[model samples]
Each structure stands twice: as C-alpha cells, then as structure tokens.
Target: MEALTTMKKKKTRLVVRKGNENIALKVEDIAFIYRDNTIIVAVDKEEKKYLCDRNLSALEEELDESMFFRANRKYLVNIQYIRGFKSFEKVKLEVSLLIPTCNHSIIISQETAPLFKKWINEE
Candidate 1:
C-alpha cells in the first residue's frame, strides 16, 4: 500500500501553442504563472517568461488545476513552488513559496478555501 503511494507521485502537463508550434510544458519545470493586471505570464527555465494572450481565469482553465492554485485574485501559482502556509489570522493564511516570488505572501481566506480546494482536486 505504501509502495503504491510512493510510486504514484502526481505531475502536471500543459499544452501550449507557441509560434505555430505546439509545445508541452511540464509543471515541475515551471517556476510560476502570474497575472499582470489582465495579462498572464509563464516563467520557466533560464528565467524566460512567456506571455499568454489570455487572462488569468482563461489560462487557469487550460491548466491542470491540481498543480496550479489561484492564491490571489491576480496570481495562479504552481504547488511545486508552494513552500508552506502560515495561518496569518483567524480566517486568513500566508502562503510561503519555494521560488523567489516577487509578489510575496498570499492570503488564503475562508471565502477562498473552497475554490482553492477545488483547484487542488483537479488534474
């Protein structure tokens, strides 16, 4: 039983179209995916950031929700980058990330917990 759990580590996969070519990006390779106002950015190896012409919500729809969590209204983060979560207040939490997050500290409120849980449950 424990062997099955150890052997079945979950992973994420993303299918994206770049310059007329279809590229598949593994979630582990992604540093983070964030939103700038309405634009979405996917940062990967070599510190290269790719711009997706879609909004955060739209991009989130294309992603495997289990691996990417919408921490705030403007940011969707990969769980691989999630270091730990701290209970900041009675109904809020501060999430620490593994990567060097520019916009550090995410508050997970009661209102957002369900949505966060849903995202974590998806593929």
Candidate 2:
C-alpha cells in the first residue's frame, strides 16, 4: 500500500518575546531551527528564539514555501541561504547550506525528497 502524506507550502511566522518586547520572524531568513526542551530554537540572521507551543508538524504549515524546508526531524533549513545540495549519498541527499555557524551537511529525509526538489526548482 502507498504511504499517506500531507504536504503544505506556506511561510512560517514566529512570535518571539524577549522580556516585554514581541517580534515577528519570518521562516525565510531562518538558518536552522532546533528544539530546546520547551522552546523551539530558530536561528535567523539575528540570534533569537521564537516562542511557539506547536510541534514540528504544525509549525511546518505555518512556514513559508520558498523560504523554509523540513530537512530531517531536527532541522528546518532556509532555501534562500542554502548554497546548494550535495550528492554524496546513495539513498538520501547530502544537504549542504550556508547558515550562521558554518557550511555543513544536513540530512534530507527520504520521505521529504520530492518536496525539497520542488522547492529548489522554484524560482
């Protein structure tokens, strides 16, 4: 039997609160997003944590189409800043991108392969 999957293409907006200040961050400028116990760690050009109570699945819908991509379970990479992809694997792609820290390899889950390709193809 075929697998069941629901794909969504949209931009994610993060509402962050640093003390008493609130800010909105776009998923486009995001370098990579990780998890930290209760908070979702999303690193953009500027360093800050966008507060959200939703899981990765729900957040995926809130994110923009061309800006962010779900690249494995722990990371959501921004396409604008992505240099390109690497073909160093036989099964999945050897994902490489330019995020704040450094250029490193990211894991593109086999399940999300088609969406990732479609995202890159878009101009």
Candidate 3:
C-alpha cells in the first residue's frame, strides 16, 4: 500500500495556451479550472485565464487532490485560492476565489457539499 501510494505522482506544471503561445505554468499558481463553451480554461492567481487543451475531467486526474477540488461540473478550484464560501439555495454552497478577474462564483451541489467542507477543513 505504501509503495502504491508513493507511486502516485503530482503534476508540477502544465502547458497551457494563451492566445497563440503556449506557456508552461506551475501547478501551484493555478487558482482554478473551468469549462467555458467548448473550451477548457485555467485561471491563475494573477487573474490571467489560459486555454487548456485538456478538459476539466482530464485536468482533474492530473491535479493534486490535496490542492484542488471539483466544486461542480464546471469548476475545479485550488484550495489555497479559495477566499470563502456561503450557503446558498438551502443545501448548496457558493464559493468565492481570490482571483480578481475571475469574478464568477463556483457552486457545490448538496450531495458534494459535505465532502467539500471536509476537504477544506482537512489541511
């Protein structure tokens, strides 16, 4: 079990597209990932949004579970970048991130809310 757990590697960086150029960005700098229209976008703490070739689901597999959480189908947010959260629509939660350009809120479903709270509180 220890061997298998140790074999699980965390991604250190990602190659993302910004306009016509591809940029190698540190994983720790990413604030969140989201699906916009047919494109997948990654936002950094600097408030810059980048185009990712991989979709949200694929990004989820590559990201470290300790740092990122899927708020919903549309968002996978970095725990360190989360500003706060508030209760919404009875059982749901609306999460606010620290990124200035990323103004939209991420919502967690009732079914996933408890798990999100646990993740946030764990470390």
Q: Who wins the lDDT comparison? A: 3
Locate the minimum summed-lDDT window of 10 residues in model 2: 1-10
Flag clash pairs in model 3: none
Q: What tens digits encode model 1's per-residue C-alpha lDDT throughout 1-123?
A: 999875555436565455666567776677667777666777764445666666777666666667777777867777766676756677776777666644545677788876765665565
Query: By lDDT, highest first, what's the ranking?
Result: 3, 2, 1
Estimate the lDDT of model 1: 0.67
Question: Could you tell me how far off, in angstroms, the CA of residue 14 lies in candidate 2 after the best superposition?
Answer: 1.6
Q: What is the lDDT of candidate 3?
A: 0.90
The list of candidate 1 runs beyond 4 A from truth reads 1-25, 45-47, 101-103, 114-123
Task: Please identify which of the two predictions, 2 or 3, would achieve the higher lDDT against the true structure.
Answer: 3
Every model's TM-score: 0.63, 0.69, 0.91
- Tens digit per residue, CA lDDT, model 3, 1-123: 888876687788999999899999999999988998998998888888999999888888888998999889899999989988999998999998887667787899999999999999996
Considering TM-score, where higher is better, how would the candidates rank from best to worst? 3, 2, 1
Q: Across residues 22-50, which tens digit of lDDT does each residue of candidate 2 receive? A: 76776565676766566666667664555
The better-scoring model by TM-score among 2 and 3 is 3
